[model samples]
Structures are given as C-alpha cells and as structure tokens.
Target: MAITSANQLELLQTAEAVAREKMIDPELVIEAMEESLARAAKSRYGTEMDIRVSIDRKTGRATFTRIRTVVADEELENYQAELTVEQAKQYLSDPKIGDEIRDEVPPVEMGRIAAQSAKQVILQKVREAERDRQYEEFKDRAGTIINGVVKREEYGNVIVDIGRGEGILRRNEKIGRESYRNGDRIRCYIKDVRREARGPQIFLSRTAPEFMAELFKMEVPEIYDGIIEIKAVARDPGSRAKIAVVSYDGSIDPVGACVGMRGSRVQAVVNELQGEKIDIIPWNEDVPTFLVNALQPAEVSKVVLDEEAERIEVVVPDEQLSLAIGRRGQNVRLASQLTGLDIDIMTEEEESARRQKEFEERTQLFMDTLDLDEFFAQLLVAEGFTNLEEVAYVEVDELLVIDGVDEDTAAELQARARDHIDEMNRKALERAKELGVEQSLIDFEGLTPQMIEALAEDGVKTLEDFATCADWELAGGWTTVNGERVKDDGVLEKFDVSLGEAQDMVMTARIQLGWVDPAELESDEEAEDEDAVDTEEAGA
Candidate 1:
C-alpha cells in the first residue's frame, strides 16, 4: 500500500488529468496539495518543528521536509544536538560555528492515511476556489433581472439554475396566485448576491417593488432616460398596483407616456405581472391632488386635511365610495402609501351633510351680524369666515377696502361689527362651557377663559345652545351680569344676526343654564300646555 516513487508519479499524473478535465489550473492543484501536506504535518508534528512541502511542476513530484535548529542544550528533543567541528565536516565541509547544513533524508512512504489526507485537502481547496470565483462573478449583478431555469422546489422555495450559479426564489418572493414548473423559463430580479462557503448565494425575487420599477423602466423609454420619474410605487402584488409618475417637462404628461397608446405600454407590464391591474397616476406637488389621483377610478370632490394627525378625508360620490375604498379598502390604502397620506374615504352623502352644516353655520354668522347684503354674506362664507371670531379679528381697514363700502361706512360698521362679534364670541364661550362642552372643544376656536365665562353667562355657551331656546327668544333676550345689561337688541341688531345665529345662541344658552330639559323641549308643545293648565287648576 506504500506510495513508491513510481506510484507518486502516477498519482500526480492522475491529478493533472482530472484538473484538465475540470478546467482547473494544475498549479493551483499543486498548491492545494502542498497546503494540505503542511496542514497534515502541523497536525502530526508540534509547532516547535518547521515543516514545508515542495512540489516540482514539471516532474509532478512532491516532498515534505522538517527543518530543526542545532542547540547546545537538548531541552527540546526535536532540535538536533550541536555537532563537533570534525563531526559537522562529515555532513558539511569547512563547517563553522552557527552554520546550518542540509542533509538528504530518505523519503517517507505515505500509505492510505496520507493519500486520504491529501485528497481531502485538494477537494476542499477546489471547492473554496470555485466559491470565490462564483462570488466575484455574481456580485455585480444585483438589482438586475436575469432569466433562469427552475431547477427544483425545496421547502416551498424554487431553486433556479442561473447558468453560472444557483439562485433561490423564496416562497414569499414568488408572485402570489402564480405557479411555475421545473425547467420552466422565468425572469426574476437579483435581490442579493452573497458569498458563502459553497458558492455565491444569489437571491432571486419576483415580488420586489424594484421589479415593478424595472418593468416600467423597460417599457417606458422616458423613465430610463430620467425624463419622467417614477416618484413612488405601491402594490398588492397580483391584485393591483399604483405608481406615481412625474415629468421634468411641465407640458409632458408622465402618466400618459407610461399608459401608452391604448395602454399598450402599461399592458406589456400588466401582462408580465399576470394581468394585475395597474394604475398610473400623475404625481403632483400638491399632496391632496396626488392622493386623489392615486385612488383611481373614483372621482374625488374634496380632500380635507388634518395635517397634525397625518390624516386626509376624501369626499367622493355615493356610488364611487366603494370604488374609492376598493375591495377591503385596498385602493385608499395603497393611495395612502403612494401619496404619504392617511386617507379616509367618505361618500357624497356624508360630504354633503358636512358641507350643509358648515354652510348653515357660516350663513348664520354672516346674516346674524354683518350689515352686508346676501352677495357679501355669500362671499364671506366662501372665504371660510363662518364664526364671530373670524369677523371680530378682521381689521376694520380691510373691511372698508372691501368692494361697495366707503371709508366712513367702513369705520362705523367696523366699530359696531367688532362689538357685536366680541359679544357673540363671549356668549358662545360661556354657552360652550355651560353646555358641558369639553375645554378641548372650546379651545378649538381659540376661545379664552374670559370669553368662555362671558359666553356661558350670556347663555351662548356651546354647540348645544340652540337645542334649548327658540330662535325668537335668543334674538329678543339680553345677556346680563348681576342685573346689569352687557348686551341688548341694539348689539344684536348692530351685526344683523341671522336666524342660524339666533338658533345657535338660544341652544347654547339653554345648554349653559341647564334649565331646558331636552326631553321636555323635544316633547309635544300642546301636551305640555295642557299639563301646565291642569296643574294650575289643581293648585287653585
């Protein structure tokens, strides 16, 4: 079983032949063998010994040698003893002190153990080299789509042979509701190219957001050229997706380009995605507009923003509510992500009610106080001034500047207008507090403590005030403190208070006084009159 000189030659030739067949460099194979020998020698011999392996490329011969120091003291037995001058001459002619000599030691015959050890080293080195090469080849391919053949399925992940290396297609990365078979040609995006002990760990993904982006880039020339940018994209994978596109040129429409003629361009991408619906929205600098577009196939009437809350209320038609919200709210949800807004979809009915309430409140404020005509009242309402505070805070000079009012009229109206506005505001604050409206709600209009107290005493405390008092009573009554009149009909007339304002004041007053029971007020007035008469007669 010993490897004679002839046997070593045959082994080296066999290794060379295998290297040629495998397209591996022979010198690398020899180096691997030498490294293996060094490892084996180190394992067998202690670190005190210097072991080296040498290989002759031309002859295909290899040798191992152990170098030792000549020491005066023999504490380390591995070090040969210092020889006398005459004894050194026997091995080296004219040897001097500290001189080293090389002696040809007989080659050790390596049996089955050495052969097995060398084979292991060669295989390990070859594998390591192959891994390093594969890592180098694939590292630059990240973020690109590559075609591969499905190799097999393991643990719900498809293994793909990407020519140079194998790539993993995780179950989650595969397009949902789609199937593939072994040997099927498929395209995937290279998510990552990682180095491992075996080889390059190429990760393939079919569900990455970049996959859609890349598809767009391929289908839209403007996108690749950077003329039209895909600002944002969101997807529900196989169901639907939304992409926001912006163009550098103001005249050019990014959405139109992406959609192509008859949607041929987007259709191409859609086909790739297995018939998934794609919505290409024109990106807008204004978030509200962008969000409206993001929620496609549904017309948006308005967008109410709650910036601090990061929420948006979108008003659409009753029929379009379901469409705007989409199945399971997918449309708005995706739109929210695409436009970076938290969207709440509302039907036209809800929106109409809200607008009607707002309009009534605004109209009441204007008609109740301001001397302006209906045209002016409507203008103020349109301008979003629906409360006394807005009018009270408006500068008199500005009011005078408004069309149809001269400086003299402006000054006179300004004083009375301000006083009326202040009185209404004060009454509203008091009414708000009296009606048990939370301090938080009261503060919504920036009402101060004094204003709240005044409004409460005047019975104009909260939104509930109108529910308690009749409109005529509120308009006719005066707000007093300690039997002293603080406000009267003159004050109310000064601002031309409208029916809505009168109603609100009355409701607020009733709520503040806590005297008007909603149940009684809500009951039939005739029945209450009969009951009162019967009680009076009984007492008599």
Candidate 2:
C-alpha cells in the first residue's frame, strides 16, 4: 500500500492519540513513527544508504532522505556514508570536506513484513517511554506511603496497581497474619523504585518499621506538622510494636498527641496494620531512661549500662521479670531494637546472686595469687581491686587506705606484687626458649614472654616462621569460621599481645631478617655498583 498524503495525516493523528494514552511527549512519539517509516523505506531504497525520515508536527508532511558526508580522500572511512572531496564535485559545483549532502527519496509502498516491523518499532518505543515516565514519577517518592488496589497475585506476591503505575508487595514484606484479595484497597510504603530491563519496578512493603512511622505520621497531626517527631520505631507486624516520640515544644506531650484524644489516632494506625498493638513511649536522651520507657508496662527496678560494650542489664522485680521479657522475649527484643542496644533482662534476685558470685570468685583469686589471708583479700576486693594488674600498678597510698596496712607494709605488698609478675614472665620466657622459640623472636621489642610462648605453641618456633606470617594471621583479621567471619579468633588473642602489638612485631621481625629495610637495601645496592665500577676501571 502506497503511503499517500492521507496516510501521512493518519500517521500524525495516530501518534498524537498514542502519546496522550501513554502520557509521553507527542514529539517523542512522532520521532518513533518517523524512524519506523524510515525502516520501512529501506526496502525500496537499498539498505546501504543512510536513510532517515522526518514528519512535520503541524502539517503532518513526511519526507525521506538519504544522507552522505563529503570528506577528504584520507578521511573516507566508509565508502557508503562518505565521499572524497574530489568525488563529491560531480553532484555539486563546490564541495567542502566536512559538508553533508542529503538527497530526498520518494516515499514507496510497504510490504506486509515492512508494515509489521513499523508497528513493532512503534510499540517498543511507546513501552520504553511509558517506563521512563514511571521511573521519573516515582523515583523520588521512595520512603513515602501510597494507596493502591491489589491488581493480582503472583506466586504469593501481591501486585498493586498504584494509579499511573504498578508496584509489587513481596510475600515477606506483607504482614504475617494479613491476607489480600484482588481489587482490595491497600496502602504500602514505597521501599524502592528501580529501572529494570523489563520496566520500572516499584517495591512496596507493609512490614517495614518505616511503614509504621509513616502510618503514625498520617494519623498524628502533631507528628506531620513537626511539633512531635518520631525518634524510633520497632514492629513485630500484626503482633506488637514500640514507637518513641519526642516533642520540640515543652508544652506539647508527644506521646499523648500521638495517642490522640481517647486513643483515636493510634487506633487508626492499628486498624490499618490489622490490629497491631503499638506502645507509644516518650523519648528520652538518657539511654537508661529511654530503655525504661521502651519496656512499657514492665516495671524496671534498675538498669546497669555497659556503654563500651553497647549492652544493658536490666533488673526487674521477680514478679515483673516475665513481663519485662514479654512472651518469648519479645518485649526485651523490641526494646533493644528501639534503643539500638543489647538488653539483658533479669530479676533483681538473679542480678544480686550474679554479683555475689563474681565477688566471691575475685576474693578467692586475690587470696590465692597475692598470698594474702581472707581478711586482707576481702578488704582489697571491697576496695574495688579486681585484677592483679591493678594491684601491681596502683600507688602505695592506695593500699595504705586498707586497714592494718602501714606505709612499710604497703611498700612490701607492692614489691611482692612486682616480684611475682617478674617471676611469672621469667618462667614463661624460659619455657618459650625450651619450646624452640628463636632467640631473635624472644628478643623482639614488643613480644611479651606470653606472646612468644603462644607463637611457639602454634609452630611459629623460629624468627623465619614469624617473619613469613601474614598480618591478619598474627594480628586478628576477619576470617571465615563455620561460614562466618570471626574477628576475635586471631592467633594472638590468647596471649597478652593486642592486634596492634602483633602487627608491630611482624614488621619488626621482617626488618630484623633484612627482608624489607629500604634504606639498607639502597645502601647495599650502591656499594655493589661502586665496587663493580672500580673493578671495571682496574681491568681497563
């Protein structure tokens, strides 16, 4: 069928209709149509020509042209697309080397295969444009909530038709007890909007903690208006949840505002979550106070924090321990998540017993190691002396504070503590030597006697063996043990040497073995070169 003037007008009208339906620029659709027509035109005019088609937007006039570039003789890379300056003179009076020559070709009739190819091209372009538009619309909307109808279910995942686009709510991201049917109205958090090979993928989630936060934002007017801010949220999804909120204004109570008048606001959120129980706690900057609030309805007797270890030990009354821990440890677990700390909940009795046991063990250790009787050991333990290192390192005045310890006695105790440590080190060094530890390794500056013994036991018995060890093997690097990387299982962990000290020892050994002393290596190379030069001069 010949592409007449009426066909050109029909093509323009069809492009405009499809562009409106797909919500894409009409100009882009026209470009796609022109390219499709150009592809069909290639069958009439040989495919060797650089064929192109352009359609007027307003008049709907279609023009097909073959393009050729005039180039210098040496610049003609493709014979079909380029012509030498001299060869181009036949078609024109004067031709510049970089000028382009376009020849108009008459529009021809299209065969069945050619028309089908044009339709496919148009459809592909429309699909791509639709995907690009969706990506641009939703990419910045990530982390926001949107409502959509459940379009279909695929392999346990719900496909939601969020107006103008579709989103997937995977099975794991759905609430455990909640079920969705087709055409059900659902709201979800836009977890991600990704441009994939097939199209734009919008991933939705209902179980994310952010989803809970967003729901609260919707229900709580103060939260949305920035009067009250949600500090943290942790959810068990359709079971229970904890949210911490703080108010910038002292007059506004954040918890009360979020709970709404007579619990209407929070109830709205719970209804959306399929009756997920939410505990709204007031946020506190103090960690212990925050943790107490996080474990709501469970009275906490005390909270002991270990800041360095990022752990907390909570002491609840014996009657309240079960409540503090909740059913199957859910309360404590959610509290930990809310506060970003590891929580260990125990009864007051259990904590007291544990402290007593630790005290007895420390008292025994001091009595046995320092050769002190029970009275003196108990006095030291009572004064907060836990390890021998502290006893050896403390000033004489510290011991003088203990009863029955005069200046001279304190001095004697210090001497004895020092002497005991020196003796232990001497014995460890002798044993390490007996175990075949090299003299160089033993003499290394940073290697303690205990570290040397550890190395000898691990078959690192010589200076050469020590020098050949990797930094991670000696010091502690992450190593896969039972399919997980362990950081504390380094070879030096059993010894007194720290990871930094282990690394230093390895470098010192390498230097001692002359393996990597750059200054010395350069000097040696220079000396050898000078000697060779002298020898050559003498021979000449």
Candidate 3:
C-alpha cells in the first residue's frame, strides 16, 4: 500500500511521542529523520547522483530532490549526459559547462514502501535516543543505592525497573539467601551503567561488599558525614560480615555510632541484609588485640607472636576454642584476612604442654652434654665455663695461670686435664647428631676432626672422664701462681662449688686408679685405736 501525505504526518507524530516518552530532545529526532532519508535516497540512487531530504517540523512536509553535475564531455548520467554550452542554453539562458543542475523528483507522495522505511528509521532513532538518555541519567549514580521494582526474570537474572530505565540483577549479584519475585521492591547498589542497542543498562548488585558499606553509610550518619571512616569491610554475603571502622574525632566512638542508639542503626542494616549478622568492632592500632576482637564471641586469654612464622598463637579457654576457630575455622580465617595475621588457635592446656615440652628438652640437653654433677654444674657456671664445650676446650697453660697453681701442681693437673678434654671431645662428637647440634657449628666453634683425633691418642674418650676432675685441681692447686696468693675461697665462690663435692671427687679418682683401698679408708678408726695404745706404752 502506498503511503500518502497523511501517513507521513502520522509518522512524525509518533516520533514526537517517543521522544517525549524517552526524554530525548525533539531536535535529535528531526535530525535522525533527515539523516535516515538522506541514507535511503543515497541507497536508491547512484553514488555520483546527489540526493537530499528535508523535513519542515512546523508543516510536517517532507521533500526529496535529485542533483546532477553538468560537464563539457558526454561523461555523466541521470541527466542529458553532458550538455554542450549550446544545449545547456536551452534549459537556461546563460547555462555554463561544469555547473550543477538540481531537479525535484515529482513530489512523489511517499508510497507504502517509503512510509514503511520512514517508520523503521524513526523507531530506530527513538530507541537510540532513549538509550543515550538512560545512560546519561544513571551514569552518575554508580556506587549508590537505588530502589527498583522487579520487572521480569530471564535465565535466572532479574530485570528491575528503576525510575528512568531497567537495571539487571544477575544471579551472582543476588544475595545468597534472598529471592525476588516479579513486582517485588528491592534496593541495590548501582554497579554499572552501560549503553546498549535497546537502551541504557543499569546494573544493580545485592551481593557486592560495597552493598553493605553503602547501607551502613545510609544508616550511620557519622559515616555519611565523613566523621567515621570505614577502613575496610569483608562479608560472607547474607550470612555475616566484618567492617573495620575508625573515627576521625577521638571523642566519637566509631563502633557505637555505627551500631546506633539501642542497636537501632546497625539493626536496620542487618534487616536490609535479611538478618545477616554484623559485628561492629572497634579498630585498634595493636594488631594482636585487634585480631582478638575481630574473632568475636571468642575470648582470648593471651596472644603469642611468632613473627618469623608470620603466625600468632591465640590462647583461649577450652570452651572458647571452637568459637575462636569458628565453624570450619571461618572466624579465625576472616580474622586473619581482616587483621593480616596468620592465626592459630589453641586451648590453654595445649599452650601449657608446649611450654613444658620446650623446658624439658632444654634441661635434658644441658644435663646430657655437660657430664658434671648438679653441684659441679652450678660451679662450672660460676667459674664462667658454663657449658661442657667451654670447660673441655680450656688450654692447660691457661688453667695453670689462674692465680692458684704451683709449678708441681700444674704438672700433675695437666695429665688429668688432658684426659678430661679428650673424653669430653669424644662424647660431644658422638652425641652431636642426637643433640641437634650442627656438625659445621661444632667444627667451627669447638673440637675439629683433627683436634678429636689428637685427643683420642691420649686415653680419655668420654664425658665421664671429665666429670671426675676436682674443681680445685682444675683451678691450678691450693698454692699461688705468679706471686698471687691462691684464694681457694675465691675460686670456689667463682665456680659456685662446695668444698665437700670437690673432696669426694678427689677421693673417688684415687680409688678408681687403685692407689688406695676402699676397705682401708673404712677401717681407719681401728687403725687409730692401735696407734694410740702403742704410743701410751712408749711414753711409760
């Protein structure tokens, strides 16, 4: 069916209606019409042929014209080829070659095909204009909340009708436990505004972390007003969330302000989140304390920092262990993220056991390697040779020079000292691996392989040999060296050793060497009785 002049007017009216509905400027619609007509005319006509379309908004009249170039040669089409000056003179009195001639196509009332073409052009223009309009309207609203009605659902994503246009709430953006029905009222953060073929696309999100932050901004005046700053926020959407807050004004309580008076403020945020729990903890500069607070409902007794390990052991009561660790360790897991600490939770009993084990290990290591009796061990510490390695490695000349030895005593002590050193070195090397002492460290600081071989040439080869030496003998003897009086008391005090232990070891060494009988020492009282009778008879 051919479109008449009335049909063209009706198309113009429809364009105006769409323009009004989409909030697009009417001038843009008119420009689109002119462009579309120009395109259609160019397609129908040849490239070299010039065609133009003009519309009068006031009268709704549309006109089309065909333009041709006049040339001197017979090289053009769409007109009388190339008109000679004499031939052009027929159309115009002074027609010149190379001049353009424009002729109106019979005001062909737009036929049915042309009318349909114009209608499509106008509709496309309106749709594009509306898209641009919606894009402009919503672009500035990113990161803000908008209330919209659910318009429809497609492939599990909801289309929501915001005031100016529709926004998409993708399935992944919906709160985990919340569902929306068509026509349902929902509030979401405007995540993005995209321009598409149909119109502006406003993307709404209910699951973004910023969603919770925005709700708090609305509910907490302090945050909105910029007095309270939200440092960070982490959420397990629709279940629970943690927000770190700090207040600019020291007098204001950031957590309290966020929580509102009587829990009214935070509750509103929670309700918006569909009953998801919110923990409003005060931010602390102290990391240990802050982490303790972040794992809420868990009372921490103490925090042991293992900085090299990048972990902190949090001690809590037996009952609070689960709470501190949370279900499947979520509480501590989030707390680690929030506070940047690798947290390990332990009950008080576990911590105690760990400490006890460490102490026992150190004590056992001390006892096994130093071969000294408890009292002699204390004495070696007093004498500044606190460890077995230190005592065993001392030079005989150095020991002899220690303010207490005579030349004869020094010689006698050297043999015993050599034996002791050899024994200690042998034992140290044997136990090195079990004691966890590195071989390289032992070689570096104490006996090397060469030194051990040299000591083995002498008969001393175990810690027990070193343990038999008398403390007084080790410190030279009872005489002075280098003209200094041998202050036996001073040496004893220095080594923290008692005289009785020293005497016993001296006697034990004699017995071991078989120079004295244990029975003769025990029978000394009877020998004294016989000697007294013989002395009394001689005096008579």
TM-scores of all predicted structures? 0.60, 0.86, 0.59
Kindly report which residue pairs in candidate 3 clash with one another.
2-112, 3-111, 3-112, 379-495, 382-494, 423-462
Q: Return the clash pairs for model 2, or none.
A: none
Model 2: lDDT equals 0.87
Clash count, one per candidate: 25, 0, 6
**What lDDT does each candidate get?**
0.73, 0.87, 0.69
Q: What is the alpha-carbon lDDT of model 1 when measured against the actual structure?
A: 0.73
Evaluate model 1: give its TM-score: 0.60
lDDT of 3: 0.69
Q: Per-residue CA lDDT of candidate 2, range 154-183, in tens?
A: 999999999999999999999998888988
- Which candidate model has the greater lDDT, 2 or 3? 2
Ranked by lDDT from best down, the candidates are 2, 1, 3
lDDT of 1 by residue, 1-540 (tens): 333567667757866876775556677777887777665665556555566677666665666676544434333354443444555667766666566655433344455786688789899877776677678878998998888999999988999999867999999998898788899998899999988755679999988878998999999999999999989988888888999899998888898999999999999999988888988888888888888788888999988886634578999988888889889988987898787666778888987888888887777767768666677777667766656565556776666656676777656655767788667667765665566665533643323545445445556544454345465443444454884334334223334454466665555456456767767766767788899999999999
Poorest lDDT segment (10 consecutive residues) of candidate 2: 483-492
